[model samples]
Target chain A: MNASTLWIFLPILTGALLLFLRNQRWVAFVAGGLSFLLALTAWLLPIETTLALGSYAFKLSSTFEILGRRLILTTNEQPILTLIYGAAAFWFIASPSVDKAHRLAPLGLVQVGVLVAALAVEPFLYAALLIEVAVLLTTPLLLSGRDKPGRGLLRFITFQTLAMPFILFTGWLLRGIEADPGASALIRQAAILLATGFVFLLAVFPFHTWIPLLSEETSPYLTGFVLWVFPTSALLFATGFVDRYAWIRTAPQLPQILSTVGALMVAGGGLMAAFQNNLGRIMGYAVILETGFSLLTLSLLKTQGIDLFFLLFVPRLLALALWALCLDILRQNAASLSLQDVRGLARPWPFASVGLIFAHLSMAGLPALAGFPIRLAILEDLATVSLSVAAWAFIGSVGLLAAAVRTIAILVAAPAELAWEARESWPQRLFIILGGLALFGLGAFPQWVLPLLNRLPAIFEHLGG
Target chain B: MLLNWLAGVLILMAGIGLFVSRDWRWNLGAMALQYLAAFWLVHASWPLAASAVKLITGWMACAALGMTLASARTEPGKEHGWRDGGFFRLLAAVLAGLVAFILATRLSAWLGIAPPIAWGSLTLMAVGLLLIGITTQPLRVILGLLTLLAGFEITYAAIESSELVTAAQSVITLGLALTGAYLLVAAKEETPQ
Candidate 1:
């Protein structure tokens, strides 16, 4: 069997099959197990080679062709596959802990399958259509039973659909550019259209209105999964673009533009996140900040930007997952996530409190937390590029730090008569404690995830030095 | 060549219908007709069999959306009238058409596509975006999406006659219809405070 069939098609069919099975917990374990297994297979197997399994001998080819297009999963892509599936497994396995998370179990698997196909598809133009399909698939996961589709969902669909045409138009132009790179006007137009497409997909400033709106309208837990998966895949898709096109990767001004955009997201997301009253929206802002950080990392493409970009996944996933878990737990007890509603919550929800605090601190890149060292390195490198960009990055961290402090103050703002108690269920407490410690574990020992992130650069041939 | 002009004119008319109508039934009718116009233009470049996919898929989506709205308890929104700024809506459509007409010449030459096809795609794209920009209601927004894609498809069909791209675009068309139905029924629940 080919890698595409085994990883992409099989999981989709399996997900369709799992839809009939109504046991949420059972489905979570099964899907999570399969995800882990797929990840492990990627880690262990060498593509485009024949291996003998005692008595059976067969080849596991890397390319699967259909409709005259190829989905190629080579040895170079092993790390990315492992990263995607490993992270999927983590999200799935941990999903059983949060309310409204059951929706993610089966549909989430299908979504991941489509996203993986988007990443693997050749003639990268097709990736735009695949990504749009993947975005539509996520609508159900975001909606609760009988709930109206929110404004966020509509704008989300609109912006995403709008991006496809631009990218497709770019693809049409790229053929012209490839035939004659001297077509300067075509090249300029293509670059602008391509960047606009990615800007929409990335939810850069003007387009980010949907993030907080969706967060406010839906469960934080569900929003977290979409926030993490779609943008990460989009960024990877963009890196693939940079890798393939000689003119794009060699463009002199691209880095400065990326840096400026990254700085904008950092400052805007961070400063805005600090002033928000709704806890869920704060999570949304953190996502925006994280995306900004990613763009900043990517701007360093001239150096080790790609490597730094990959390192972000491990800490970001851990932080968002932990943060989302705590918020979901709090959501069960409080009427709403507004400051007035969650006031003095820590007295009864100590473990959730700790988990939430650690997560917030880590995202703010506080020293001794998981995000610290990497944030420090990126900022140092960014400063060498331009101190103004570095200053904006620093201001962003401080803004997030301010938000973290404000959140702590509210959680501990207990009435005098209120007393501390561990009111969280055992499962909630266990996961939080473990998740919290994992953040610390990765922080103290960067080696735990750095090696995996280090290998991700192999997937791109020319872009990341 | 005359048939292409008639098809382009029909496209702009259907777009005008979509631009001002709030009633789901009328909107669907306009959309189905828009697809027919698109099919006629595309058939000039692609095989009849390939061109028919756009027609069939577009009608199927309209039928699906129509069934949902017929069964759906609420109106698509308040019916459009002078109070809803009908004159302004017509003005917008006219402006959009004018812009499309202006661009069609350059696009036809640069992309080496037919003038009729370029005009058809560009006009639909402009009107579709106008529809999306004006509406927040789910069904109308989705209609706008379908309209935009139809516009893209007309030109795209002429440029790249790949069956794979055609199928993928058709699936996207259907996916938008299904999702639109989903959002319509989903309106039963109120927004959380």
Candidate 2:
């Protein structure tokens, strides 16, 4: 197989082989080395043409086909795929330093499965299936000694499963329209189901109760994987449908509806996040609010909007990865995720606390950091469409910013209490330094990053649909 | 015309029997009757030879009926009386019936056995969405999911059938159902009665 195809599946194949290697140290070293090389190659190599497995191939660098109907991956997909696999590499590198969790091999394999789902043409059902399998994979990781299952895994599985029929059926409805050419009735039906599935999967508003609940129970690493990879993959998958189907793209008021839903999620998630004292739950809210902003960008429906959508991934992946790393550190060091427990942690674990703050700022879309340029681009696009949409988009950013600021304030002002006296290992300290540097690097010179994102729209302009 | 009338009668009788009947055994009987009615309706439009797998799936509904009976507690006198049980059973049966009816109508249209109507697939989906949205009880939710699945299956018949998506969905449905049933049993055990 060619490099592009090989790059995509190599990590997956290595992960599978790791299961029977009978050498943990060798597996960790070799796996980390191989994943780093593959990610480097995927980043450096020129994009390939269609790479097919059987009857189906990843047709567009952005799209694929499922069954008989097309499941388009948009041109916006490449940067996101790069970011995802890149972060997966980072997580793998850090895995050795983190706690000894079982089933490392399968965990990496599941990560590959999620990446494949992201690249899958019909992400509708296959993505959800991958998510369910991911959840099952985590059961062994999350539930070690406990005989009774926690509500967290169940809630996660239920919510994920609940979204399945919505997606599958929506796809079915859209296919039905193609059967009897030029049926407006089927179009509207497909649109509604599509929107409903989006809401269900995104955990928009009322359907989002599972986020904080599942957040509380799952580990920082797995929780971060669920929040970032799965949901972001879903967003990428949804982008395919909007990009490919001109009917969806051309819908008169659909963009407005999407923006409105996104704005609501931002406002609602922010308010809830502000009330939550738990760090993990706050991270969940922060991610949700950011998701709102992503949707808002998608709603603008312009080249800039597409660019902003692609741009959003960079900061989010870096910030969430750093944040999850910090959480993993804090959980091991402090055994608590409360703001109160983390107070005065700056004195002892200055590197981690600073990393957390920077990550939070990046997530908040603060100026100069990773999230700012993208959010700014989205607002500019929105302004071009309508002043009111721009205002709504701004309103969404404010909530995210407010939540981040609140997290920062709490991290600083809480009464000093020594919860645990733990020293950071050399590896943890190195990760914190690296993470901080990356955040500062991205924040200081977003121009360098903007060009990378700039490539996304060009790709989309040519072949996204 | 006679076949349509027979299908309609069987469905209606099964629906009423499911809701009004007091005995648990009668619930199984009504569920079986409803499946039979649905099978006949599915058969009337798509010939059995062409749709053997689906026909066998219809037969497997009998196994689902048996499984449901096994799942229900045998307590003759519980807080939820025959009335409550009957209402739920009937509600599930009716939702399934509505799904079957929509499928039959669409299939008939597809086969040129009936005049094509506007929004045929749309109407079925709308009904399924309504059922799923309104239900909270596990049994009802499963029924709602089945309704939603049926709507999609009929829609798929009009489109390309992917053994890929179908096989994937079948495995998922089986696993989900087993998980749901396990959860129900666990919930029953956990609740302080």
Candidate 3:
């Protein structure tokens, strides 16, 4: 059996079947268990190699072909598969308690499965197509079919659709450039096309309006999952482009451009996040801020960057999941997530309040939490290149810190007569506490993730080298 | 040669009609005709079977969307006079078409494609974007998106012609329409009892 079929097709087929099961709890267990099993298999089984269980032996192939195109997931990519599916399991396992509609498990599974294909698909440009498919899959999940569609959702779909043509055209242009080396015009056009495509896909700076908008317009859990999955795949695809193309990798200004753009995104998302009143919008801006940091780490890949990029993922995902869960819980109990609406919410829901505060502070890179070490390391690397880049990134972090403080103060602002109580259900509290603890645990010992992260960059041959 | 010019004319008309009209039926019809013309133009380069799929897929998209809007509760598209930004929009659209005309020749030469193909692609794509930029309505945005993508596919088909890529683009087209149908029903103020 091909690993692609195991990792990609199997989950998609299962998700489709789960769609009809009609029981939310059953959907959660079946999907989550399957996701966890897939992650474990990817972690333990070496692809394209024979393995024996007692007297039985088998080999799982790394590549599969469909429609004359190849999907290959080598042993080097097993860690990434494990991480992606593990994250899927994280979201799915929590669905029964959080999602009443039963949509997240089945559709989320399908989207996750498709995103894995985006990472594994050969000729990498086809990844754009797969990403589009995933984005479309997410549209239905964004709405419960009872409410008016928000303009943010509409803009989100339009902008994502715009990206595919630019990327696909870049593929054709790149081939042209390859055939006619020294055709600088073709090379330049290709660069513009590829950059524009990514700008749209990554929701970079100016194109990022939809992030905060979508978060505020939809359920926090679904929007949070969309934010986490889409950009992670896009960034990896981008690194593929950089590693595969000599022109892009060899460009002396490439790192500078990346750092500058990264710094701007951090500054933009951070400064904007500081002023937002809605809890969901704050989560959105925080995501944008971390995505900026990811790019900063990405620019340094040839030096100490690739490892830093992968290291950023676990903490980032953990913080987002926790923050989203807290907001979701608050959303359920409160009138709205606005500052005034959720004020003094800590009186009844201390764990959720603490989870919310920790997740925000963790993303802000406060000392002793998950986001700090990688943030510090990236700044040091950026300073070596240019202090202004580091300064801009620092300023962005400070903005987020300010926002986190404001949130904490508001969450605790209650009258003395109010009594403290843990109103969160046991399952909700367990997920929130575990997520919060993972943030603290990962932050205090950064090396715990290094073994897995160290294996990830090899997925990009040139960058890893 | 005359037939190619006729195809180009039809593509331009379909794009402009969709760009200006508020009526969903008019938009879908123009888009449907636009896809047929696109197929005719691409037939100059691609296999008859491959290009024909574009026409079929595009029509199926129209049918899907048409059926949804047929059953869904939607307000009648009100006609606007010059006082309601209608004149300004008409003027703006002509300017957009002019820009496409000027750029179409250079794009044709640069990409080594036929002039008629370039003309149709740029016009449809530009007007599609204009449609998106102008309206907040779900149906309009999806129609605009379809036109924009149809333009892109025309140029892309001429360049790559890989059946897989073509099929993938078709899937996205149908997906967008189906998704649009969902959005329309969801956007309705009251669900049927």
* CAPRI classification of candidate 2: incorrect
Instruction: Report the C-alpha lDDT of model 3 over B125-167, residue by residue, as the tens digit.
Output: 8888998898778888888899899989889888887666777
TM-score of each: 0.97, 0.74, 0.97
lDDT per residue, candidate 2, A334-430, as tens digits? Answer: 7578777766666566667777777877777788777776667777777887787677556656666676676667666645564433377888889
- Once fitted onto the true fold, the runs of candidate 1 whose alpha carbons sit more than 4 angstroms away are B75-77, B189-193
Which candidate would rank higher by TM-score, 2 or 3?
3
Model 1, B1-193: lDDT tens digits are 8899899999999999888776677788999999999999999999999999999999999988888777765455566577668889888998898899999999899888889889999999999999999878788789999999999999888778766788889999999998887787787442210
The global C-alpha lDDT for each of the candidates, from Candidate 1 onward, is 0.87, 0.60, 0.87
TM-score of chain A as modeled in candidate 3: 0.98
- Quote the true-contact fraction of every model: 0.63, 0.13, 0.59
- DockQ-derived CAPRI band for the predicted complex in model 1: medium
* lDDT for position A304 in model 3: 80
> Candidate 3 — which pairs collide?
A300-A305, A301-A306
Best by DockQ: 3
**TM-score attained by model 3:** 0.97
Off by over 4 Å in 3: A53-56, B73-75, B190-193
lDDT of 3 by residue, A354-442 (tens): 99999999999998999889889888888887899899999999999999989999999998999999999999999998998899998
